[model samples]
Target: MKNLVLGVNDAIYRACIGVAGLAIVIMALIIPWGVFSRYALGQGLGWPEPIAILLMVLFTFVGAAASYRAGAHMAVNALSDRLPPQVQPFLTLFVRLAMAAISLFMLVWGYKLCVATWNQYLSTLTWLRVGLSYAPIPLGGFITLLFVLEQLLYGDQHKRRVVDYECTEDSKEAV
Candidate 1:
């Protein structure tokens, strides 16, 4: 059962990484083309900016999920680390609960935003719906919620620890 859950988590992590990487690469190419078309061609494309922004949203939100799973997100562990070993569990639990609350907010409000803007169209790109612009917000929140649940149940970033081999002695030796 643990192996199955971990396998799913690993798959999600890899998918997030791949999506973020693809979004970044596409943004890189699009930005340059937008610049070239505007200055060199004297006819700026109308779609590039919107597309780039969407891609950035994709990269940021998905990348954040991946980072959180890997324990790469910035965290203030200094104080917690100094606490007595017995107190550490409580501290970690408190922090995770706080994180869960924030994730819930993002999920709720983000989805609200998406729904609110559902009828609206992008000014720059008429064909695109404005609701889609806010997709990353809810998506990222949901992804984070999944990770947080995993931690709350299993303790710590179990998926990434295994996926990244963070617990291996060799990694510590290198550091």
Candidate 2:
């Protein structure tokens, strides 16, 4: 059961990285095309700007989930680090609980927000539903929630090879 869960999470993490990276690459290309079209071609393409914005939203949320799993999310540890060693465990548990709460909020509210706007379509991109753009919110929340559960149950998986490639490379550099 443990291996199965870990394997699934590893795959999910990889998928998140791929999706976020692809979104960034596509957004980069789209923005440049928009600029070129507006200034050089003498006509601004409405689709590119809105499309890029949507891609950005996708990137931010999906990338955040991957970041959390890798233990790369921004955190201020000054206070926690200063606390006595014995209290650190309690603090860690509190932090995890807090994350779970935030994740739940995002999951519930984000889904509601998405449903509320489901009927509306983007002004520039009529084919895409406004609700679809908001999907990453709940998706990210759910993914983060899974990671939180993994942490609480199995402890930090940050040292897992799939998530710690940078550390592996750094060690190679030292050799």
TM-score of 1: 0.87
Using TM-score as the measure, the top candidate is 2
Query: TM-scores, in order shown?
Result: 0.87, 0.91
What lDDT tens digits, residue by residue, belong to model 1 across residues 97-135? 888898888899999999999999999999888998999
Q: After superposing candidate 2, which stretches have Cα over 4 Å from the reference?
A: 162-175
> Mind giving the per-residue lDDT tens digits that candidate 2 earns over 1-175?
7777888999899999999999999999999999999999999899998988888988998899889889999999999999999999999999998998988888999999999999999888999999999999999999999999989988888877753433455687897
Count of clashes, each model: 0, 0
The segments of candidate 1 whose C-alpha lies over 4 angstroms from its true place after superposition are: 158-175
Worst 10 residues of 1 by lDDT: 158-167
